[model samples]
Target: MRNEIMRCFAVVFTVIMIVSGCSGREETKTAGGGGEEDTKPTYEFRLAETHAPDYPTTLADKHFAELVHERSDGRIKIDVFPSAALGEEAAAIEQVQLGAIDFVRTSAGPLAEFNKDYAVFSLPYLFDSDEHVWNFLLSEHGDQLLDSLESSKMLGLAYYSSGARSFYSSKPLAGLEDLQGQKIRIQQNAVNIDLMDALGASATPMAFGEVYSGLQTGVIDAAENNYPSYYSTGHYEVAPYFLLDGHQRIPEVLVISMTAWEKLSEEDQELIRTAAKDSIAFQREKWAEYEQLAEEEIRDAGVTVTEVADVSAWQKAVQPVLEKHGADYQDLLDAVEALRP
Candidate 1:
């Protein structure tokens, strides 16, 4: 009877030990699974623009944010700050270069300082129409220009529409003669300054954010931008005349810091590229809609909208600028001229 009881106790002890060992193994595997999950990195990206959230570029950025989130399976996220929320265009570009900011949507004018090839886009009458600008941006030449930023630690993702920048002033400007001796605000680009000077205006380089105050205080008698910007920034209230000279059709760039870009997985990179392509299409549509809406809004606000009889008059005035910069910008000029209708 003693031997029988000992055998039974031994069997029970072995079974309990086996069961506890199995449980321990399962617990170890569970802990390892948790650790692996924790190892997955969560990347957050920031995008900054100098326009309002309602603008086409901002809308496209919002779409970009959504696409990134969806494509990355929530592993990546993007936050957009518009209306110079981060800083002015030049400041934002510098931040991206230093990796202090992840992304920026800035006009080619500011970017030209970093990459001289971009200066071609700032030349007056480089693009004849919206179609011309759009086609060139989608071409191989455009890709080459955009990719050139790689050396600067900035990667161009896509180009956003800046529309055509013409003149808006408190006084009427029918042609080049009307602009003689007038002070006009322009982006701090040599080509733009030259273009304004050629057209007989005293070009003053100023920040877009300061234009309203500058106009109000009579620091600048005129300024130029696209129709949407004129309405969105309320510049029309102060400068109530719009001249459709279409001197410069500068496109805004969507760029990412190379530091941030390289951190993304291959799959994430594909996702970004695909999303940017789609967002570009979306932006173009929104831009068309807003252009009409802005025109109506500004007109209703008592701004005079005038279409010049001869854009050639304005173009001729800026011809000297092209002559000086044309050799260096020949490739871009040729590309623009080659764009099919």
Candidate 2:
């Protein structure tokens, strides 16, 4: 009877030890799950836009945000602030460089101040037409330009269409000579100032917000922008003369801070890049539609829309600007010009 009890106890002890050992192994394997990483970490970022919600660029920013969130499966979230809410382009760009702001939609004008090579886009008549501009943008050279922002502590994701800037004034701009002796409002930038001065106009650099009032009060005689911008800002109410000289077709860039970008996983980084490029098609389509509507509405609102028959004269007028800046960024300009297709 003693032997029989000892045998039963031994069997129970062995079975219990085996069961416990198997359970411990199972727990260890389950915890590691074949070395898969945790997937619950969430990331959030902010992007700034200086345009109104209805503006094509702003709309594109919204679209970009949507695509990123959706493709990231909600792992990444982007908050977009429009209308200079975060600050103007310069301020926002500074914030981005400091990692205080994650992203911004800004013109190449201000960006050129950071990289002289960027001024290649600011050159008047750099592109023959909208189609030519797109070809260059979609090419590998454009990708290299976008990547060049690494030196600025920012990453250029993509370019949004701001369209070609033209002369709009309260007075007639029937010819290049008409620009003579006019106090034209321009973005507070060196290249634009030089460009206006070359055209025989007195370049009065002013805040974009002050432009409407300036035009209303004759603080400035003329200004320049694309159709949608001229219409959206109510500048047409005062400066109703729209001349399609199609000067600088400077593109608006979508950029993110290198600091913010580096924090992202490599996979997520690629995801954002893909999202930015994907938004380009939608943005271009929206910009074209908005441009047409803005043109039609501005015309209907009694704005005189003039088709400039001789852009050659205007182009020739700005040759000095080209020569000066071209000498500064010869390689960049030459590369851009080579993308004439």
Candidate 1 residue pairs in backbone clash? none
Instruction: Give a tens-digit lDDT track for model 2, residues 1-341.
Output: 99999999999999998554321211111223678755444567889998898899999999999999898777677888998898888788889988888899998778877766677787788888887888778788888889999999999999888889999999987778889999998766677778888999999977676789999999999999999999999999999888888887888999999988888778989999999999999999999999999988998999888889878778788999987777877776676678776
TM-score each candidate: 0.87, 0.87
Q: Show the lowest summed lDDT stretch of 10 residues, model 2.
A: 22-31
Clashing pairs in 2: none
Which ten residues in a row are the worst by lDDT in model 1?
Answer: 22-31
Off by over 4 Å in 2: 1-37
How many angstroms is residue 82 displaced in model 2 relative to the true structure, after the best TM-score fit? 1.0
